[model samples]
Target: MLSPRAIAHKILLHIEQESGYPDRLLQSYLDRYDNLDPRDKGLITELVFGVLRWQGRLDSIISRFSSVKLKKINPVVRIILRTAIYQILFLDKIPARAAVNEAVKLARESQPDYVVRFVNAVLRRVSDNIESLKKVDKTNLTASGIAEIYSHPKWIVDAWVKELGTEETAELCRANNKTPPTSIRVNTLLTTSENLAEELRRAGIEVQPCKYAPDALEVKKGHFNLQRLEAYEKGLFQIQDEASQLVAHILTPRPEERILDACAGFGGKTSIFAQLMENSGEIMAVDLSPWKVATLEENLERLKIGIVGTLQTDVRKLNEMNIKPFDRIFLDAPCSGLGVLRRKPDIKWKRRPGDVYRLSLLQRDLLDSLASLLRVGGVLVYATCTLLNIENSEVIESFLQNHPEFCIEPISDTIPWMKVFARGPYFCSFPHRHGTDGFFAARLKRIK
Candidate 1:
């Protein structure tokens, strides 16, 4: 019986205090509160994600109005203020009075009378000055200004400014703030993209074929409960990004080839590999978490894909394992995950500048350990869902320096749509440019 604001506040509290992912936590709440109508569910999701996405800007506005430091304010009260402020500033459909009234109501339920008065005073002030409060000077392009304007952490803004330059970084930040379109890859093994698109349309879903990945479909409208759909039950598609689908295409696994998915978490690309090989190749999917390995196994069954074999082990130590050499090796190494900020806005707040350097080291170790597993003349596709130079190009450059036998392979010849994403020898996609998650991928071939 909890209101959407109440539910969002509870979820945000956990996300802030425990570093829990907002999507997972929100899904859990939706599942737990099965009685919540679709509208309430939508509101809960919007409030939680919206507040997290714009937390930096919201805090700036709060600092402008309140004497209290953001860190010193009670976490629950802070989230309440943010939710109200977001609606006031961004949501045109939501009347300012409704947003303020709801916050005051929620405040009364959780805090003392004085705290309720504080919430009322602050929200009323924000609502009254909402027009002026929304205007941020776009001409000021300082790192701190960019951070405030874009609602991204100062460190992330500064890093992007240095690597991507100010204008492009601002564009990236703006893209991250916008709601990302839902993209899914059709399981070509079960159905063709045309057939799947027709089926989804028949089911009242608006979908369009993705230009980059042949199998990708962009769902423009309609409910996306894939689990409840007959197509999903029959394993016709899996939710994946268009850019992510391109990673497997770069590998170009042939029938009956031996492949190693070195960092397969829940087997997104592993399943793609199976489909690419027409379910004839043997894919050894490995991940550090046993839970992920189990999930991958379940997905393999659900997709009716039998060629993939699962291994629960850290990819960094794969050199010590007695696994056989692979004709192709895929190292989807972990990075700062800055690229998918549109989907996971909380990461921008939680991630630190040092995390990128630490992850780059791990990425190097993964490549070095897994490179030996690739057969001479075989392919190795190094990829990350991040736009950072330290994690993408730098990692591959460092690996090539140490391993002379492996050389960068131009992705242009691998797929017909290469012109859309090929960045010299590397493949890169940006949210602002490609309308896909920002991703960087390199195809390397072993020469020795």
Candidate 2:
């Protein structure tokens, strides 16, 4: 049996080499090491996510100790030190000596004896100065750039600095580094919220009802794999963010209304719409990739969704027959994913400043193509998992310029709880501000 640190090392290497998502990847790795106690499991998860979240800060510390530049260090050893130092600084329960010893053991797997010794020395240095590391002054944004130190791209920090002020930007960066809570959407079709709450209690799970969403629940304690829980396998609920759950309601599809969920990957919100319409509406879910749309189709079948019609086609182009116009539509446009950095930590490093401008261009093309399929006076809800102005408000502002028939509509009556929405009927959320994923959505009505 491999030690938990060795398993973590394997998982960390995969995260560095592959394009897989962290949650799924981490869960898969944990499935192999089933005997790990919940406490150890939690530690491994924290180390993995923390290293990804603060790679720059870890790298900066590594740079201070090693002759090699941060990236120039051996990938395996680098990840080991990162995992060790993360525990030393952030995790109070893991003793510094244990952290250093585990790191040395992990390094010995591939490196020679001398390389392991080097890792031990470097990590000891970090452990000795954990307090100073925690209190490092971040006042100078340029010299010791807070954004980079906090594992965020400098450009995003610049944008946040301009929009949220310097002090607020640093706070936002720090908040994003922390792991987001697990939010699950209860499947209303199978059971009511109250019934599911009772079911969760039966399973010995401590859960809290979502304040804003009637069907959402936040896991407070008792970390059980949701899949094995009878509530989940029986189609009782799904893990989805609160902000994402907002998208379906913002559209406010009526029973028997014709709607298209363009870019409906995995069908989480699409299933919500199916439930809301009480299986009485026609929903066409379109996505560019067949693989993603297929998963959605599978989910619809599993959840007994009768009203949803799945299709694999680009949202930028609709080629369905006898589909004149939809009463309501959602683009759920793909963008830089800046808003979801907490869940998708790699996105922060993967994204470039210019990606926003480029994605904004694609979003415009998608909006233009999809809006044409909406009937006059129809409601179109445009949404993204991105918080930047260029991708949200600015793009919507530009679109309204070209299409005068479409105008922003009041969303207060629709979503009463979300008071801090974007100006002019657009809904914008920040993780730090709304306790939800940073999201942006705009409601528009087409007037002929």
Candidate 3:
């Protein structure tokens, strides 16, 4: 069995070399070593995510200590130093000497003796100046300074500064770097939030009611495997962010209505639609990937929901099928995913400046295609877990400019309690402001 550091090294190397989500890759590796102790698993997770979260700052620090430029270093050696430096600077429990020793040992596996010695020299330098290097001047408001201090790409920092002043952007970056809370929505069909919270607490898991979403609970403290819990096996609740849970409330499908969950990824929101409709409505849950469709079917089955049907086809293809207009539609369109950085830090490194514009085009196409599928007077909620206006309001604005038949339905009037989260006609939640994943949702009504 690979040690936790070894496992982390492999996963981080894969992330650097390939195009895949860190969470998915980490889970696959952990599953292979299921015999690992829970503490070991936890450490593996911490090292992999911590290294990614602080990669930019780590590289900056490495540059200060290494004679070789960061780009010139061997890929594996770079990953080893990154993990060791992450543990040294971030993990208080880990001794700096142990971190440096483990890094040298990891380097010896594949690197030459010279490279191994190089790794030792750099980590030792980092340890020696650890206190001085750790001090990030918050007053340095330049984009590059904020980028290095917060470990975000400079382009992202610049964009955010333009949209939300520098101070707010810094706060947002700070929030994104921290660990996100584990929030779950109670499956009201099976049990109430109170009962589920009681059950979880009885299992020695401390949970508190979510401030906004009535059925959501934040796991304040717990160490047990959530999937192993009886409540989870029974599908009494789903692990969803409180911000995401609020999207279902925006849709608010009624009994016996026909709803279309466009771009439903494993039916996270589709299940909620079934619950709100009290299983009286028919939902055509569509996704582009066949595997995701299969998983959606399984998740619905686990939740004991039967009112929804799954389809595996590009959402744009749905127009070719002879389907009747629906009472409601929820298009959780794909975006750059900047909003959930705390949960998925790899996105900061993976996404580029142009990705937002590229995704906005697709969002527009999906919105236009789904608009024809909604009957006049029906509601369609377009949502994305991204903070970019290009993907959020700009797409909506361009659509409204072209599609005169549809008009923005103010979320404040539709869901008064959400007024605080609303920016005029749109509903948005900021990680820095609302303590939820950065989410944007716009309600539009098809009017003749």
Candidate 4:
């Protein structure tokens, strides 16, 4: 019978110190408390994600009122303050008195009397000056200022500003803070997008066709878990971003062709490729993690796809496996995952400035190793759910320079909405502009 705040505190503490994903941890808690009402569930979700999303700003405000530095504060006490301060600053339905009272109560339960007093004093001050704290003067926006105002790390804000310009970077940050739409791709093998949309509407789920991907449906309203839906169980659709759905189309895998999903993590794109090929092609799906390969195998079974063969092996060691060259190859290389921050807010805090450079080198090595596995004239679609130049364009440029046999290919004919996300010969989607995750994909063909 834990309160929503209590549940959020436990999840936050674990997220701060442990290795569990917030979404998975939250879902496990929700499932454990099956009798808990939707209101409590919603509150727990909001508190956990909101506190994490705005942790930087909350810490800044907390430091302003407390004599103690943030790092010096006990972790439990820190999360309690963060959760309370988040409600006061952001959640309008929550009264200031309730936020402060709950925080003090939680603090009293876990901390000493002095810590409770300190928590009460800081929160009361924050509550009294909440209006002033809400206002940020956007007229003079520096990179550091944007970071503080938007609750993103300064390095991320600075990098975005340098790459996307100040105005667009701010817009991107704003988009990242928004709760992204739950978009799913209709599994065209079993049902058409039109039919799936009709079925979802009949099931009382509000959905609409996405503009970017032909098969994507943007779910507007639904309380039911999508996995439990009749359509989902029947393999009518799979939860995927509109931008991600486009990568498989960009590769344009033909029926009966041999394809390789070199870094297939959970098989989102592999599943789509199976459907696009009408489950007729041979798709060798490889991943470094056995757990992910197992999950991909489960997905392939649920989707009733038979063309994909699962392999649990490192993508960089594909040549060692003695696999044959394929007509199509998909290298959805791992990067910083900056592009999907809206869905995974914790990434904004977990990633360091140097991690981007390190990930970029890994991406380059992946491309270099996997490129040789593509047959001459075969299409290799290199994709990442990241927008950074070092990870996207720079990696591709270096690869093309080192291997002159591959050339960038235009993707306009791959799908009808290519014009929506096409950047010359490459596919790029921004969260702010595309209403989807920031993604970069390049279609390269071997010319030798």
In order, the Cα lDDT scores of the candidates are: 0.88, 0.82, 0.91, 0.89
CA lDDT for candidate 1: 0.88
Per-residue lDDT tens digits of candidate 3, residues 81-199? Answer: 99999999999899999999888988988888999889999999999999998777789588777898899999999999999988999999999988888898899899998899899
Clashing pairs in model 4, backbone N/Cα/C closer than 3 A: none
TM-score of 1: 0.97
Give the per-residue lDDT of model 1 (tens digit) for 1-448.
8898899999998998898767778888888897888888888888988898899999888877876788888998999999999989988988999999999999999799998998898888888788898777899588888888889988888888998899988898989998888888899888998999999888888899887787899989876365567887788989888888888788989999999998899899999999989999799999998988998898888888999888888887778878788999998888899999998999988898889999999999889988889899999999999988899999989999999998998877666567678877789899998888988999999999
Clash counts for all predictions? 0, 0, 0, 0
Task: Name the runs in model 1 displaced over 4 angstroms.
Answer: 413-416
RMSD of each: 1.4, 1.9, 1.4, 1.4
Candidate 2: 10-residue stretch with minimal lDDT = 136-145
Candidate order by decreasing lDDT = 3, 4, 1, 2
What TM-score do all the candidates reach, one by one?
0.97, 0.95, 0.97, 0.97
> Which of candidates 2 and 4 reaches a greater lDDT?
4
